[model samples]
Target chain A: MTPFSHRKADTVAALGEERLISAIRRWLGDVSPPAPLGIGDDCAILPASKKAQAITVDPVIYRRHFDDSIPPCAVGAKLLKRNLSDLAAMGAKPRAAVVALTLDPRTRLDWLEKFYRGLAACARTYNLAIVGGDVAQADKILAASLTLIGEASGSRMLTRAGARSGDWIYVTGPLGGSLLGKHHRFTPRLSEGAWLAAHPEVRAMMDLSDGLAKDLHALTPSNAEPALDPALIPISPAARKLARDSKRTPLAHALGDGEDFELLFAVRKNSNRASFEKTWLRHFRQPLYCIGNFVSIGKRPAGSIDLNAHRGYEHLR
Target chain B: MTPFSHRKADTVAALGEERLISAIRRWLGDVSPPAPLGIGDDCAILPASKKAQAITVDPVIYRRHFDDSIPPCAVGAKLLKRNLSDLAAMGAKPRAAVVALTLDPRTRLDWLEKFYRGLAACARTYNLAIVGGDVAQADKILAASLTLIGEASGSRMLTRAGARSGDWIYVTGPLGGSLLGKHHRFTPRLSEGAWLAAHPEVRAMMDLSDGLAKDLHALTPSNAEPALDPALIPISPAARKLARDSKRTPLAHALGDGEDFELLFAVRKNSNRASFEKTWLRHFRQPLYCIGNFVSIGKRPAGSIDLNAHRGYEHLR
Candidate 1:
C-alpha cells in the first residue's frame, strides 16, 4: 500500500505530525493572519514590533518532566509556564508563545479544551499572546513543545556564566518536590529573575530544572570548585514521600526528581538574603532556600551530584 | 500500565526522546551559550540583544514533511529549512533557532547523528546557530518542530497583506513541481525580500507555500477583488512529471503542489522586472513567472483555492 493510503491519523494518533496538521486545519480557520501565511507553511513568520523583541521555545516530555495526571489544562499551563520561565530565566518580559503538540489520537477535545483553557489562562495571566501552533497525532501517548517570543531591552538580559568564584550561591525558592507537588502551577519566576538581573549583586544564574544536586554540579566554577554537602539538602513534603515510597533518602529525590522551575543563582557574599526575601518571597507563595555556598576548588570530587547516594533521571543508563 | 509507561517511547524501537536527549547532551557540551539556561532546562532562554529582534516557528510532520527513506541528514536540513523559511518570509536576517523533537520509540542514535549532521550543515549554510531545543519520546511516527529567532534593523518587516490593486505580481524562481524537485531545498527568498522591502514601490509580499492558487488567493485583498487567468499559471519541470504521471494538468500541479519555496509578490506597476531579475535571478537555476494580476472582483468566484479544480498534499480528507 502507498504510505499515504495507510496514513490514517489514528494509528499514529499521538505522533505523526501530518495527522495533527490535518486536524488543526479544520479547527483553525483562515486566520486573516497579521503576518504572512498562518497554518499550512513550513514556518509561521510574524513581523517583529519595535516595541517588542520577539521569541523563545520550551520543550517537555511526560514521565521525565511532568506527571501524567497533571490535568491537561495544568499540563498546558506547565508547558507555557516552562517556556515563559525560560524567558523569565533570561530576564525578558513575556510576549507570545506558539505550541507544537504531539499527542495520542485518543486525546479528546475536552482534554484539549482544558489544556488550551489552562494554557491561555496562564498566557492571559502573564499578558502574553498565543499567535499560532500545530498538533500531531502520536501512537500511544502525548507530548508537547512550546516556542515563546518575549521582548526585553538588551541590557536587562543575564546569563549563567556571569557568576564569579567569590559570588554567593542562592536559590529563588525551595528547590525540591517540583515533580511531586503542584509543579503544573509553578510560576516561571520571571519577575524574580528580571528583578535579580537588575540588581548588580546578582552575578550568575540558572533555573533549577534537574534537581539541586545535578544543577549545583552545573553551577560549580568551570575553572575549579569545592564540593558540596550531601547532608545539607532541604527536603520538601513531596520529596519526603518519594523517599518513603521508594525507600530512598529524601535528599536523593531533592537532588534528582527534576522539574523544579526555581532559579538557582549566585550573588555577592555580603548581600542580605533576609532583606531580599522580605521584599520578594511573598510573590512566590513558597519559600526559597540557601542550601550551599559557592566556594573555590578544594580537595574533593570536582563536586558530586551526591544523588543522596541514589540515582537521578538518566535515559540510557 | 501507568500513563507514562503505557506510552513508553522505545516501544517501536525508535529509542524515543529519552535516548535522544542523552546523546545530544554528550554531543553538545556547553558552547558559548547565548541563553541563560542551555539544553538542560525546559527551554533554552537566549538573552535578547536589544539591537536585534524577530522570532519564527515552523512545525514539521512525518509523512507530510519527509519520508522514511529521507536520509537523516536531510531530515535535519528539512527541519531547519522549515523555520528558516519563516524568517526569510519575514525579511528577517536569520540568527538562532530552538528545536522541539518528538519521535517514535524506535528512533536510533545512528539516525540522530545523520539528522544532526544535516542540521549542522544548514546552520553553516545560513550562518544560523543552534541555540537550544527539547526532546521527547512518543509511540507512533517521528516529528520535529524548530522555532527560529531572527533580527532586522532600520527596515520595516514585510508582511503578506501589503499587496495593492493594480500592482504587478511577480515570483522569484520557478513555480510548481515540488514533489520531484528540491522543493525541500528551496531556501526562503530573504535577500530579495530585504531588497524589496527597501524599495517602497514594492507593495504587498509573501512566499509561495500552499501552492499558487491558495497562496495567491490569500494575497488578494479582503472582500475578494481579483481575477486570475488559468493560462497564466507557471509550471516547473517537476510539476510536469507529477501532472504527466498523475494524468492531470501541469497547471493543476503547480496550483496545488505546495512547497515551491519561491517568493510570490507584487510590486508597483511601473517597477522594472528586468533589473530585479538581473540582480537576483542569476542565482537561481529555475524559471520564474508572472502568473497573473490583481483586478476588481466581479461576480467571478472571488479569487480562492479551487480545491475542486486543483489539489496538493492533504493530511486527511
Candidate 2:
C-alpha cells in the first residue's frame, strides 16, 4: 500500500468518535482527587474550595501559534503552560482543567495520542487534574483551547491593576527571542509569583506574553508611565544572537519580540529592595531584576527609553 | 468607495487589538457579585463556594457549527447555551465563565460587537458573569470557546452512571430537526434538570446532544439495554416538516438528528408515575414523555423498535 493509504487508515476519521475518545482517555490516564467526576460525564465536578478561585482560558491554533516544526507533545504542553502562566500571574495554584479541541478529520490518531500524553505529563508534574474535554471536527487547521482553574494561594490574589506611582517594576528573568525554542519549553514562574503575592510590598503583577514595551502598559496607572533603565534590563542571549541577523537592535528585540512568558510585577517603592531581593534569592534560583519604576507621565527620567518607539506583537494587526 | 473598501475599513484588523478588546468589554457591560474580576485581568477570581462545582468547555466554529445564514447574535447565544446545557445536565447553577475567541482578520467589527451583546444578554438572563477572555487571530475561520463554571444544586449531583436495570427513560421535550431554528434558539433545560435532580426518584441524567439513538448508550448498563417505545417518542413538528424534503422517516429524524438540547433522565422503576407526573405538570409547562425502560440485554420488549439501525451524528466520522 502507498504511504497515503497507510496513513489514511490511522487517521481520526477511520477511528471514529467513540474510539478516539477512548484513546484520549487512555492517553490522559486517570482523574485524581479534588475532581470526583471527569471525562465520561457531561461536566466535571470539582471539590469545594474555601480559597478564591482563579480561572483563565487560552487557545493555541495551528499556523497562528505554531507550525509542524514543533513536536505535538510540545504543542500540547504549551497549551496548558500558557494558561498556567496566567494563573501564576494571579498567584494561584493549579487545580483542574478542561480542554476543547477542534481537529481536522485527516489528522493522524497517533499525533493526538502523543499530544494528550504530553498534556497529561504536564498535568502530573503540576498536580493538576485533566477533568474533562470536548472534541469536534474542523474543516482545516487544528486548535486546542484550555481552560485552567486555580485556587489562590491566600486571601490576596495578585492582579494587574493595583500598581501605584513610584512602584519598582521587576521581572523574574530575561526576555525576548522566545521563537528560538524557549516559547515551547520555558517554565512558568508559579512559585515566584505566589511568593511575591504573599509579600505585602508587591502591589500588582502579570505574566509577560507580549513584550515588556507593550505589557508594561497594563501595570501603569493612568497618571504614570513606566521608566526603565536600559542597562538593567536583562536581555536574553537568544535575543542578542537573533539581533545580529535582523535590522533591529537587541534592545528592540527585548522590548518588542513577544512571548517572553516571564513574571512582571510592581513593588512598593518605599519597601527595602535589598532585603526583598535577598529573600527571593534564598527561596528561588531564578534570576530576579529590578529594571524600572512607574513614574508620573511626562516626567520620565532623562535618558529613559521611549516605550512607544518599540511596539510588541499584536494579534489581528 | 467600493463595498469591499468600506467593509475592509470596518474589519477587525482595522480596529486593532486594543480597540476590538475595548468594544468587546463594552458589549459585555459589567462584572457582578461572585466574580470580582473580569475582562481586563490575566485571570478572573470567583468567590469561594461550599458546594461542589461543575465545569465544562464547548466551542462553535464557523462552518462546522454554523454558517452566515444564522445571525451573529444567535451564534453567540448558542455558544453559551451549548455549554449551559452541559451544566444543566448536572443540575448546576451558572456562576462564572471565560471565553476564548479566534477570529479572521477580515471579520467585521460590528459582527463581533453584536455577538458579544447577545452573549451578554444570555449571561444576564442566566445570572452568569463573563469573566476573563483571550483573543487571537486565525487564518480563515472564526471560532469561540466558552468555559462555564457552575455550583451543584445541592449536596447531590446527578451523573450518567447511576442508571439501574428497571429505571424508566424520559426526555424533557420533543426531539429532532434542531436545524429548523431550535439549535440556535432552544432553551437549555436548566430549571427542569435542577428539579429532576432534586427529586429523589431521578437516578441518572444528561442533556441530549447526539440524539437518543446514540447517546442512550451512555446510560445503558453492562447488563441492561435501553428499550424505547416508538409510540411514546415525542417527535417534533419540525422533524415531520423536514422529513417531507428528505429521504428519512420522521421517526428516523427524531432518532438520529442531534442538537436537541433537551434533558434526558432515568427515574426509579417503582416511583409513583401519576404523582410524579402531577408534580412535574404543576411546576413546568413543558411536556415530559416516558419513552421506555432499561431491560435485560437479550430480553428486549416484544416488537420494540431496533435502535442499531439508527445512528446519531458523530464528529470526526
Candidate 3:
C-alpha cells in the first residue's frame, strides 16, 4: 500500500476537484499529433480522418469490475484495455478517447494520481489521444467509463453478424480463468484483429469478452449454431488450476469464464486452413486454434458438446 | 409515479441486463441515415466526415445531478443536455453519442425505461444519433456517462483561450437557480452557438455551467480579468425567489449559484455592439445580454464589482 493511502487527510475531498483534475492532466501529459484542442476546453477537436470511425463505450465499476486487491494502475489500464478490445474487435485503429470518472470523495488522491498514470501509459503505448473528460463526485462507489474512437482499417469493418454456416471459428489464444490476473494484465489482440479483418477469407469477428459459450452465440447466425470440439478448445493453464479447487472441469471454465479479451473470429470453410495458420503464425506470436464451426441449427457434430448447456457471466443476474 | 415504479418485482435485477438494453435500443429507435454498424456490435461504425470532430464526456450521478423529486426522464435528459451544452460551447453540431450507464440493481425497470425515453427524445430533438452504449450493475448508486461526438461547424472552432482584453462578454440567457426545472429543461444554445462561430466577431465562447463567477475565469486570458456590470447580470426569477429566503442576494445567486447552462461568449472589441444585438434578436427568441468586458488586470472600471470576492459551486468541496 502507498503511504498516502493510509492518511485520511490526503483524500480527494480534502484536495478538491479542481486540484485533482489538474493533477490528472499533468499525469496524462501530451499526445502525439496533438489534438487541435484538448483538455481545459469544452471539447477536444479531432482532425478529419479519411477512414470511417468506430466508437465504443465501456465502464469499470468497483466490486463489479475490480476489487481493492487490484492496484490502482491495473484498474485504470483495465478500463482502457477493455475499450481497446472493442476497437480491436471491429479491426479499428484507436485514435482518441474521452473518459468520465465518478469517485467517492474519500478516495485517496495518491490512488487517483496512480490511476491516471497507468491510463496515460496505456494511451501512449497505443498512440491514442486522451482528449477530454469530466469528473463527478459519487456517494460511495468509484467508476470510470471510457469511450474510444478509432479509424476502420479498410472499406469493410467486421461485425458479429457476418458469419456463414460452415465457417471455421477461431480464437487467437487460450481462454478462461481471467480473474486470476489476466483479466486486467492481458494485452488486446489489436494487430491480429486488423490482420484478420484485412484477410478476404475472414468472415465475422468479435472479441471474446463474455466467454466463448456466450459470445459465440453472437457470431452464430439465426439459421446456424456453433459446434465446438471439446478436444480443440484451448483451455488455459489458469483454467486448469482453477478447476482443481472448483466443481467445474477445465473445459467448462474455458468455455464459460469471461474477460478472456482474445480475438474470436470465423474464416471461410473453403480457405486453406494449413496455409492460413502458417500466415497467422508468421504474423503473431500468439497461438491460433480452430475450435469449432458454425453448423445448421439441428445438425450436431457426433461428439460435440451442447453449447446451450453452458453459461458465462451475465450482469444483473 | 409510473405504474411499475412501486412494484417490487419490476426492478432491473428482476428484468435482467439484456432485456433492459433491448428496451433502450427500442426507445432510441433508428437514425436518419442509418449507421453502417450500430448498437449490439462491438463498436458502432461512423461514416467518414469531412468536418473535424469535437469529442467530450460527462457523467451524471444519482444525488449529485438529481434528486428523488426529479423524474427519471428528466434525469436522463439532463445527462445528454449537459454534454450537449459542452458541444454548444465549442460551436459544434451534434453528431453521435455512446452512453454507459451504471445502475443500482434495485432500480425500477419502469424508471430506467422512462429515462431512456427522455434521452431518446432529446437525441431526436437534436438529430443526434444514439450510436452505442453499455450497462453495468452498481452496488447502490445510479450513474450515466455520455460521450458525444460532434462535427465542428467550420474550419475554426471556438475555445475559452481566444478571449482578448477589451472583448465584451455576453450571455445567451438568464442565470442562477436552475434547480427550479430549468437545469434539465433548458434548450442547448446549439443554433446560437453555430451562428456565433460563423460570425467573424465572436472571439471566445463557453457554456456557463459552474455559474458566471467561476465560468467567466475560463474565458479571461492570462493578462486580463473579467469586469462585470452588476446591473447587466441577467438574474433569473428563480434566483430572486431563492434569494428571498437565503442570506445571499439575487445578484449573488446569479453569480455563484451555478448549473446555469447558458452560453457565455466574448465578442471582438471593435464589433458594432448594436448591430450584433439586432442580428442576434432577429435570429433567436432567447434574449442576449452584454454583461461586461475583459480588461487588463487591476484596471477595473470604477463601477465594476471585484469578481475575486464571489465564489460558485465547486464539486467535492
Candidate 4:
C-alpha cells in the first residue's frame, strides 16, 4: 500500500471549502494578548504596541477567480482590493500591502506591467503603498496573493463576534449576481468602512464576500443567528437584471450568489438605523440596506423573516 | 488578434524570473518612512509604531517547488519556513503567520490535517500563532503562500545593502544539493539571526535562496560587488555525497544549487571574525564560514575569483 493509503478517501472536494476552513479555524484555537482576532474574521487583528493593526492575506487564481475574458489589470486590482475590503470590514484604514505572484512561464512582460499599473492605481487612492512582493514561476496557472496591513482607529478593531442579540444588521450596497464580472471591478468601501469604524455604535462588522445568507451567519455570535427580513434585502440592479433574464428569484440570488464585496455590519438596536443610513448615504454614494436583527440560537422568528439557513457558494466542490 | 496579443512577445519565461524581479524592483521605487526595507530584500521592513516589524510573503506551488515524493506535512512546513527564513534574514523574531492555500479538489482531507499539524509544530517552537488565511480551489496545482510577521529587536532592522568594501562575508552552515530533498527539512537560522541582529557589528544580511553566486550580488551596493575566495566555500555533506554520485564538483553545486536557506551576512572590518565565530558556535551549534570580502566595482581580485559574474538558476528559463 502507498504511504497515504491508510487515510480516509474523503478529500477537500468532498468535505468542501467551508468545512475545510472551519477545520482550520478549529485547529488554530485562540489568540494571546497581542492578537485580537484569529482565524474566523475578515482580517487577523494584532496589537502593534500603541495601535491595533489588522492584517489579511487573500489570493486569486486563474480559471478559479477569473478567466481570459478579464483583463490582467483587473486581476491585479482585484487582488489588492479584496484585502482592502477585509480591512474595511474591520473598520481599519488601509496602510500598506505586499503582493506575491506565481505566473505561468508564458505570461507576457507587457501583461505584468499593466497588472502592476492597475494594482498601483487602486492602492494610490487610499494612500496605500505597494511595499514589497515576490514573483515566481508556476507550471500552468497564474496566481496572485496580497497581504494587506491596516491600522485601527478609535483604539478598537471591529470584529464579526461582537454583535448583540438585538443588534440590527445592514449591508452596504445591493448584493448578488457579482459573478457577472463586477467581482473584478467593484470598489472596496474604504472611506465608508473607515467612517463606520470610528463611530461608537457600529457593533460588529465584516465584508460580504460569501453572500448575505452565509455571511450574516458569521456576524452574529456563535450562540445566536441572524433573523433577516426577506423584503428588506436590497437586490442590486445587476442582480435584478440577471434574475429577470434567467427567471430566478432576485432575493434568492441576493442571499446566495456570493462575492458581493460589500460591508455587512451591525449596529445596536436603539442606535437609530434610519438616521445612520441617512448619514451614510450623505457621506457615500452607496445605498445601505437594513436587512436583519440577531436572535437567540434555536429561536425562530414568528413572521415572514427568514432564518439564515441557506449556504452560499462552496468553492472546493 | 487576441486581446493580449497586441503587446511585444517578451514573456516572463523568455526574460527570466531574475530579470523580471529586477524590473519589478526598479518599478517599486524607494521605501517611504515607517518602511525600512522594500522590494529587494527577503522581508519588507516596517515600523510597527515603536518597534520594527519585518513582513514577508512567499508562495510555493506543486510541480515547481515540490512533487508527490515529499509528504504534505513538509509542504506546509516549508511554506512557513521559507517566510520565516526571510524574517531570520532581517534579524527579526517570528511573531505570527497567515497562510493562504489554493488546492486541487483531489487533495485529501487527511493530507491537509497533517499539513496543518506540521505547520503548528514549527510555529509552536517560536510562539508564533497561525493567525488567519484564505482557502480556494484550483484546477490542477496546489499552491500555498505564507505571510510571516516578525518583530525586530534592535533599533535598526538589517537589510542587504549595508556591506562596505572591506567587510568580511560569512554564511551560516554549508550550502547546495538542496534539490536532493533536504530543502524540505532545512531548519531556518532564526535564533542565530536574532542574536546577530542584537549585536552592533553585523553590517548587512540576507538569506541564501537562489544560491550564493547570484544572491551575493544583492548584498553589495549598486556600484560595488563581492570577490569570493571560491575555495573557502563550505559545502554541505549532502552536497558532497550528491556531487560524488553525479560526478560533478561540489563547489559548483554550492555556488549554483538554490534553496540553501542559510543566513549569509557581512561583518565590519574592525570586528574580530575569530572571536565572533567562537561566540556564534557557543550560542548555536551550526558552523559559520568566512568566504569572501567586498571590493570596488570593476576591480578584479588576484587569481580567478569569479566575480559573481555567472547567473544562477534563473527560473522560467
Candidate 2 fnat reads 0.90
Tally clashing residue pairs in candidate 1.
26
- DockQ (0 to 1) for model 2: 0.82
Query: Whole-model lDDT, candidate 1?
Result: 0.62
| Pairwise lDDT winner, candidates 2 and 4 | 2
* Positional deviation of residue B191's Cα in model 2 after best superposition, in angstroms: 0.9
Q: Which rank order by lDDT, best down to worst?
A: 2, 3, 4, 1
- Listed in order, each prediction's TM-score against the native is 0.80, 0.97, 0.97, 0.82
Candidate 3 CA-lDDT value: 0.86
Q: What is the C-alpha RMSD of each candidate to the true structure, in Å?
A: 6.3, 2.5, 1.9, 13.6
The alpha-carbon lDDT assigned to residue A279 of candidate 1 equals 64
Q: What is the fraction of true interface contacts found in candidate 3?
A: 0.91
Q: List the residue pairs that clash in candidate 2.
A: none
Model 4: colliding residue pairs:
none
Chain B: TM-scores of all predictions: 0.82, 0.96, 0.95, 0.81
Q: Could you say which candidate leads in DockQ?
A: 3
Residue A13 lDDT in candidate 4: 27
- Please provide, for model 3 over A1-317, each residue's C-alpha lDDT reduced to its tens digit, 9 standing for 90 to 100: 33134355888888787887787788888752233466788899888887889999998888888887888888889999999999889888899888898887778888887888889899999988888888898767788998999987666678877789999999999999998999999998888878888988898899998989988888887898888999999999999999999999999999999999999999998999999999888988877999989899889788997988888888886
Across B168-242, the per-residue lDDT of candidate 3 in tens digits comes to 999998889887778888888888889988888998999999989988888898999888999999999999999
Q: What lDDT score goes with residue B123 in model 1?
A: 76
Give the worst 10-residue stretch by lDDT in candidate 1 chain B: B1-10
